[model samples]
Target chain A: MPENSVICLKNIHKSFGDLKVLKGIDLQAHEHDVISIIGSSGSGKSTFLRCINLLETPTEGEIWITGEKLKLARNKKGDLDASDPRQLAAMRARVGFVFQNFNLWPHKTLLENIIEGPTQVLGKSKDEAIAYAEQLLRRVGLEERKDFYPSQISGGQQQRVAITRTLAMDPQLILFDEPTSALDPELVGEVLGVMRDLAGEGRTMLIVTHEMQFAREVSNKVMFLHQGQVEEFGHPDQVFGNPTSERCREFISSVY
Target chain B: MFDLKGFGDQLLAGTMVTIELALASLVVGLCLAILAATARLSDNWFARNIALAYTSVIRGIPELLTVLIIYFGSATAIMAVARLFGYDEYIEISPFVAGVIALGLTFGAYASEVFRGAIIAIPKGQREAGLTIGMSPLKIFWRITLPQVWRLALPGLGNLFLVLLKDTALISVVGLHDLMRKTTEAVSYSKEPFLFYSAAAFIYLALTILTMVFIHFMEKRNSRWGDK
Candidate 1:
């Protein structure tokens, strides 16, 4: 626990009926800490990221965002739920999420999609939100395509817009769940480029990614999960170059 | 030698009534359908069962029977309620009002199923995207789910509307002077069954064509995003 910690999760556990996906995972991200979560498929990388914002509610955990603890209560089905819905919503508003699938609303144009969170949840005026959205769209090199529907754009362009949409909320932390996993091989670079810029800006980000090279290069800290547990977590060089865990070393070799 | 000199105005008036009835019922039915579909998809067991029972009972019986029951039953039911209030006067339910209720209830039941299917056709990711962005569940439905559902449900709803237009003829049995009822009166009075009946058929056909054109325009409007 550091004084500047932005998000802290302790003993996070998630289960689906009889199957446990995440078991006793702990992570504390400070401001400007870019952490990359890397593991093989079914290793709970995405689930661990989703639990931070309560997307997939953890079975048992204490999550604190910017030092504010999230309150949870057991419902009739014995599944945990937010005791105060408004608190959950307010907390979620401050934590941005980028899905693996672009998941852009097809009905709205690129600019409209980017401004949705700012106008709808943040209660910014339409003119102000639109101006901010235009700026974000310009930064992503999508200024000209602001009026295009998501279906009209390339997968890489859509993912960039999705990132811009998250960024528009001015969140304290951003969680990317394999943001480029669904893009084509050639389209991956465009999305990675945008993420690289975000990382360079010193934003706190937790990314679940299969891009080993990009993850190794951009992230200051690398977390390797194996069999629903944190097998190795440390500086990228130590974990990637000389991981103590045998399983993590094997995974690194297989992916590389 | 078709001569509809005396009954032409009566037929015209009846066509207006039919159109008015159809439009009113469409509005009522659409509102009810949205409510029922949402209830049917909700987590509350009571709401689900109530919506299910409404759709099931209304859909299982004939539309004609529904019209008859609503026309006759409502008057009796109102009288009983009035008696309970210590006011005993015979109250009559207008045929137009009864017809609207019966037709709207029937249309709502059928349209609810159409809406439910449309809602399910949307990807789960769309709603999840809204949730992560911090929109309330109601906001998600209004902004994200309802817009997509409306687009998806348009063609299906158009077909139901054509059927609803034709079903308005059933309202004539309850003594409302709709197209069918007017035609019947003209036929018996003039003994020109072929001419007057053919005229009524033409009017109904014209109305259906107009409705189809309107629905096509609506479909085009909804596809402004290019059906992607």
Candidate 2:
């Protein structure tokens, strides 16, 4: 692992019964590197991203973030032990994830949704949380719609708010799981634009996306996963401009 | 010929008791429903099984039968225990208390399902998002889960409450002077069954209409954010 690497996944393996979704995958993400994982649907790109945050625990392997190996173990009686709830919670706090569905809390106003994490999770004062929420809303260009509910906003606007909600957590790493897959084609550009802005601002991001243009343009590194393994992993230009793997070449051609 | 004025007072008194019993039961039922729904979703097998059994047993039995069991059977058991302890010769369970317990238990059984559905309707990602932010489970329930559950469960819960309000009449058999019981008493005394019964039916209709208006206001207030 590189000295500057913020996230390291070593020999990571995950399976759902007999179906091996992620097989012995190793990945290292350095600070401020926007690593985009691109592949066809069911390539385990999303599963791999979810495993990084322990949303879905790996069946076998080690995940290290900021030099600490996250404690993922079962008890003698074969149950998840409750002793490390704090550690698990702390690990989750450092990694924020955005879902494809823009899963904003429907009961809360846009502003409340944005502030909820800061107030409830971080124990920030209500006024401070609100102020930070407003800043994030403005940063994402949704300040005018801060009072609107998720159901009231357009897909593009809702995605932007989802991004702002993630930013409010002040995570060291942000994971995007097909962030634009649920948006309309016309609305896709707006969400991608926000992501592009985040990339420009040097935010460390691991994005799972189908948008070839985004993978090519915004990512510092691109990894192509086919059949539960990283087939090609390198700079965007090296992989996209001149691919070594026949599968990578075929995938790039099919999409482009 | 019936004396209409005297019959009206007795009916009014009965109507008040019925309303009180229904409101009390509804409040208690909603509280229990939330707890049971939470337990039903818990990972612990004991908690989940207990919640399931409570809902199943209450739902399977007829409401009138439940009332009879609690009012008669439980009262006897309680009096026996009291006698053993030498606290009193006979420990009487009031019909009003029995009615509340029976109705509330039944309401809770139905309301648990409604609450569970609403909780499940919320996207799993929202709770994940809450956890990432570091909110304790209790705070998450209040801020993230509760508001959404209330919104989703409103229609189902409102319908249940209406049914509960009508079911208050069943307590009349246990000798609690509810509206239905009052109507019966008034009819027997005045020898005018049709006139008093019609009055009682109208009262129920008026209460139902009033409940609808209140529920409409609540739904509108709660959904105001969605319209923005």
Candidate 3:
């Protein structure tokens, strides 16, 4: 692993029952790198991103994030678990995750969702967390709706709030699992806009998306995932424009 | 056609006793339900099987039989334990405490199912969200999970609560002077089974109506003024 690399996944393999989803995939991301992974529904894009944080633990693999190589042990249930829970927790803290459903904790208000991680996990003072939350809400253009519950907000607004909530942890790496996939066509643009702004700020992000245009425009690197492996990966211009692999071309054409 | 002037105070006191018994039993039952549900959901084989056994045993028996067994069984155990200590005297277990234990055990079994369903209703992502933010498992459960579980479980628990309240009448068989027992005494003296029984039914109905109103208000408060 490179000294400056923010995340490195070595020979990651994941299976569920008889179905092997991710087949010996490896991934690496550095600081300020915005990598977009595009693939079909079952191509394991989301699974790859989830494996980075051990959310869906890779059946067998080595995961290194934020300078720590995590240890994996087969638990009694026959599934992999982190050998050192404390180490995994610290690693998770550095990796912010945005889910597909924009799970903003339905009972809590938008402001509360933003401050939860900062106050509870980061040990920030209430006043300080609230202050930072307000700024993040403003950045996402949801400041006026901060007091509203998740159910009361529009899908677009909720997704933006989800983004800010993940950002509140001040994670060095951010993993986005189909962030806009659940949004309506009209709502997708607003969420993508917030993400585009985050990319402009040079945040290190790993996004699994179906948006071809967003992948081509906002990301510096684009990876075409096919059957749980990176079929093609390089600069966006080469992957999307030049197209060396047949499967990558087929996928690009299918989406376009 | 009922003459309430003579037995009104006694009936009112009986109603109060009934409410107190039900409330205490429900509180105990809630604690047991949380424990049983956690055990059922535990990853360990022993804990899960033990919780399953508890629910199966308690739920399989009739409520009246459970009351009798807990009452008489506890009394015997207490007396035997006392004799072992060189104190040769019968130990009396209060009907109230016995009733609480028996009724609470029955209620707890039903409650475990309610809580399990509520916990399942919550989205899996909520816990994952907490974990990704570095919140400990204990913190995640108390903060992210329990509040949602309470909201989801309230209606079901409230439904069972009504049934459990009515079941308190069964405790009168063990000699607790609840509403049913008081009404039986009043009927025996007056020779008007119809009148006293009607009064008893009215008291239960009135208590149930009041409870439903309070539960409705609580539902609204917990909903934050609107449905999700």
**Residues B1-228, model 1: lDDT tens digits:** 333768888898899999999999999999999999999999999999999999999999999999999999999999999999998999989999998999999999999999999999999889888888889888999999999898899998998889899999999998999999999999899898999989999999999999999999998987877545
Clashing pairs in 3: none
Interface RMSD of each: 1.4, 2.3, 1.8
User: What are the runs in model 2 whose C-alpha is more than 4 Å off?
Assistant: A1-4, A75-83, B1-4, B7-10, B83-88, B136-138, B225-228
Every model's TM-score: 0.97, 0.92, 0.95
Q: TM-score of B chain for each model?
A: 0.95, 0.94, 0.95
Candidate lDDT values, in order: 0.92, 0.87, 0.89
Ranking by DockQ: 1, 3, 2
lDDT of 3 by residue, A185-231 (tens): 99999999999999999999999999999989999998888888889
**Which has the greatest DockQ?**
1
Give every collision pair in model 2: A121-B133, A121-B134, A121-B135
Span of ten consecutive residues with least summed lDDT in model 1 chain A: A1-10
> Each prediction's DockQ?
0.71, 0.53, 0.61
Give the TM-score of candidate 3 (chain A): 0.97
Collision count of model 3? 0
Q: Which residue ranges in model 1 land beyond 4 Å of their true spot?
A: B1-3
What proportion of the true contacts does each candidate reproduce? 0.66, 0.58, 0.61
